[model samples]
Target: MTTITHRLPQKRHLVTDLPGPRSAELTERRRSSVPTAVGSAAPVYAVDADGGIIVDVDGNSLIDLASGIAVTGVGASNPAVAEAVATQAHHFTHTCFMVSPYEGYVAVAEKLNEITPGDHDKRTALFNSGAEAVENAIKIARLATGRSAVVAFDHAYHGRTNLTMALTAKSIPYKHNFGPFAPEVYRMPMSYPFRDDTGVDGVAAAERAIGMIDKQITADSLAAVIVEPIQGEGGFIVPAPGFLPTLAAWCRENGVVFIADEVQSGFCRTGDWFACEHEGVIPDLITMAKGIAGGMPLSAVTGRTELMEAVHPGGLGGTYGGNPVACAAALAAIEQMSSLDLNARARQIGEIALAALSSAAESLADQGHGVIGEVRGRGAMVAVELVKPGTTEPDPELAKAAAAHAFSRGVVVLTCGTYGNILRLLPPLVIDDDLLREALDIVIEAQTPA
Candidate 1:
């Protein structure tokens, strides 16, 4: 029989073993110098990626279910992305949007304002990463409201910075020895339906959190209450249905800026443009990054024009905030997302994942396997937490095992959650159905008894 080759936008060429020879060499080189903690995720040796497949240094290709930590949604190596990048690179790269502005940067901000959730007169400020976007959100809120206190939630994963670390939930890995973190950042209990006590009903979890901030954090001096509609790294944990709107309502009443950290959940990764739109709640400020620039480094804080304008001149920019190439890539990425209907595609992907994940979890339960206890998330940002089963206790060791097992089978998966027991998937939206199913099957096969 002859082989028929189809030119897939995403390429997969398993020329050598997983991690291949060159990848192993690079890993060894890094192990000698880089910190041990940073070497955990897939050994970081991919040389190229396109659409949904990542190719390693030694010519090994694996399905990239972890889309650069949920960054590249339009697809890896997209023609639009590449063309935009190349065109911008040819025409001068950086002028520091602050020192001298450019059309590309202004256009990107305009696009964000028009597309981001919230119909009010919105504005945007670009930055280098999600962390910086979040930092600016705090600054804008403080300057606008004349308040110093900021409120976050338990089990939330905002970013990795002085202020953001204080906003984040975990400490051992992201925050340990990195603090004394920024002050006046208070954490309220998030409404984790999976583990919430009856003291706060699922539907009223937002009210409960608001009460905490009101009673404990003191809204009198509060600048903002920031939240991820679907908590990302703390686990792909979706808040209860009414939680966001209720929280937003309280913020409105108390004059606290409602900041939505949509870095991980925005740009069609969720069913909507922004996760906050799931409940028709328009936040005072929204921070975004990750999937914005087709894998390029870019982020933005979009919000009410009045609030954004509150920040004085020369207070909100970076040397590389809106790099022209990155801005061009982002414009192309947004166009691609809208043209391809990736938002709807993301919802469909979630449906596919939900059915397969539930069935696989049930099979594992029947077989008495001690991994994959629960599946939860919205759209393509789905997760399954590994556990000992029939208990609330987390099983990080089993999660690590499942991740390694998936990598061994030519699939790249990432693990998150405060306990580090949740395995999450973030395949590019352009991935073909067969490839997605293939990756899911690989994950299933990895869980079977050996």
Candidate 2:
């Protein structure tokens, strides 16, 4: 069913029940066919999505707060984006960028160079997913630095590919049965202010991690040190103020490249154009995806020109890497983000969201039954890790219950983190104050003293 919602005062129509009788029947059928993990997030299937709401086959409209896991920065069904995609599709689709060079793909590269951080000459190679971008970054670093070892922080999530899985911190869902990952991957503790004690502050945490690397993986043997300015699935963690700069300085001093994985926190999702901009540390490579092309499957690796040149001719290319249609959509999405001041808008949304959720946590703290252990993130990319209390313990039960309660109503939220105890909110920046407040109400009610 196609959804029609124009302008403000968004209308939510639930012609059927939450799952409706038809959807329930379809879901039952799905159990026999599809893997159960498919429906783990929201059992209710999405029939249609537009603006900031998802309409189910049962005709239940849900206010989307997950933004497709922070992929759709500019609303779900942007008219301009739709027009761009349609226009490009009518003309042509694929011509492997490496085989037959195209203007659209080159234009995207030029745009990435101009938009990405740093005044140094930058180069970009388009990819199909965040994992691809990350893998490419590792390859680039290895080739440029002529080293085999890479240092990654604990709680970091790069991607799901073999190499990326080795880089990823958690091993439950992403790396459970899969074995024998890429070599030269090292994981170290992060600047988790919420967890550490003693005087091991944020910069101190970086120092500690760096000290370990200095002793174990010498800079002479390391290719790069990959990090996330604001960890996405790892509890929405925001590292200490000087952590990134300190690490970057160490990398520069030791002849190791610094790669920032901004897949989840880039493209205006974190108020800044990229989370790395929060600090002026220009990395040797930056992997980006998610909101890069609005809702389209687009990812890129922007890097120093000389470093990117290390790759051999025909070393990197994909048929769908820069499909013209997706490129056109990306152009429109970037235009929308700039003209609409979405970066500033992201800050506004984040400020309001933090205020509301933090207030709720404080209220419960007074009662000694608080679940929101900590609220941490930058700009609109925010999360609340639920815990029993006074401890860093993960509260998966509360998080699951909160998510289910939101789904039962009309709000769609996503639960993430290694522990699956973080309630992540990625509402479209276009969401109205009223709708946002209403969604907040649902969250509060779910955790209320019922």
Candidate 3:
């Protein structure tokens, strides 16, 4: 793989305290301007970023482990993506594909069709966000199958949109009091090995979910079953082996559309182009975003040609879906992922991060600071779930404390999960080995009990 040289210094440097004077002023201003509901994990305001480092306004260089919630996998300021965006903007910004159309949008669709799982004839539709892609995927499935009910799994987080809010499981924050959500969405048990009280293996757990569908909402009423191969906001839970394959097979037998929500785990983030490839489970439809366009806002839903064609031409579209500049960025980002062999790079990162985190968890347990319930996740998208020392009870306070600790020490870490007890690490795929190890050391220190 070719080495990626970042413009900024790769190491973390604290020139001033986190949320320094400049950031504090911005925070004060933001409190009055922006709504309180839109929370920010890091208090510092970023001036620039590249590779695995984010430079704040106060001249603090912090290690970036969150990758802007799994976007920018190629890097925050990849030269190719930036150049493409600039070139596209120079030519023309938005002609609105629905109006005049352009080659960039077609090219992006072609690339998505080629890269997404399944060799079958496929079609692609671009959107502005992951939630939009998911919503459109569900719309296509319903129209194609002539069914109303859609099934989502436990601990799943689709998005914040009203329809997606109903699909999401957690009550607090994401779905709290935001009721009268779209109907016909059903929740089923997921194959979460760590939290499974039944102690069932992958196949049995899938059977349990299938049984629920059989009893409550039969297959005939179910239009599609959407799932994240690796649950993202839900603690980076990788379902036990055979779980995804069993569900996909069942969906096929029942004529229900199977949609893989790869919004968080797609684009070589999980040591594969998509996490479903890990299990060889090809979905009829797949939703992607996050890392698709470097840091540009772009999302897509790629699916079987027939299923996608079911929607009338005018039925699926938005004003800014597949904006020209974003498509250009996506094309360049995909090329970067291919030429740099980021899939292999992600595997290497996984090995390093998992080993370090696992060792830390063991050390903490031996020292009787056993808040880490489980260290899990694949590739660069890794996390450790925190729990009460002796029991499986969640310890969200510890997760928050650890994240705060990391931030204070010049590392940016993110916490997610229904209970907000999992510390997730999503470093850029191009992060240098030395820099990654240094960041991991700081993360280890932050996770340690004080």
Model 2 residue 173 CA deviation in Å: 0.8
Kindly report which residue stretches of model 1 are placed more than 4 angstroms away from their true locations once superposed: 1-13
| Model 3 residue 384 lDDT score | 89
Q: For this target, which candidate reaches the highest lDDT against the unseen true structure?
A: 3
Measured by TM-score, the strongest candidate is 3
Task: Kindly list the per-residue Cα lDDT of model 1 for residues 245-312, writing each as its tens digit.
Answer: 88898889989999999999999998789888888989999999999999999999999999999989
Q: What do the candidate models score in CA lDDT, each in turn?
A: 0.86, 0.85, 0.94
Cα lDDT tens digits for candidate 3, 1-450: 588878988988998988899999999999999999999999999999999999999999999999999998999999999999999999999988899999999999999999999899999999999999999999999999999999999999999999898888888889888898999999999998988866698999999999999999999999999999999998899999999999999999999999999999999999999999998999999999999999999999999999999999799888899999999999999999999999999999999999998999899999998888999989989998999897799999989998999899999999999899999999999999888999889888987866
Which ranges of candidate 2 are over 4 A from the true structure?
1-16, 37-40
Per-model tally of clashing residue pairs: 0, 0, 0
**Residue 425 in candidate 3, Cα distance off native in Å:** 0.6
Worst 10 residues of 2 by lDDT: 1-10
Comparing 1 and 2 by TM-score, which wins?
2
lDDT of 3: 0.94
TM-score of model 2 vs. true structure: 0.96
Against the correct fold, how does model 3 do in TM-score?
A: 0.99
CA RMSD per model (angstroms): 3.0, 2.7, 0.9
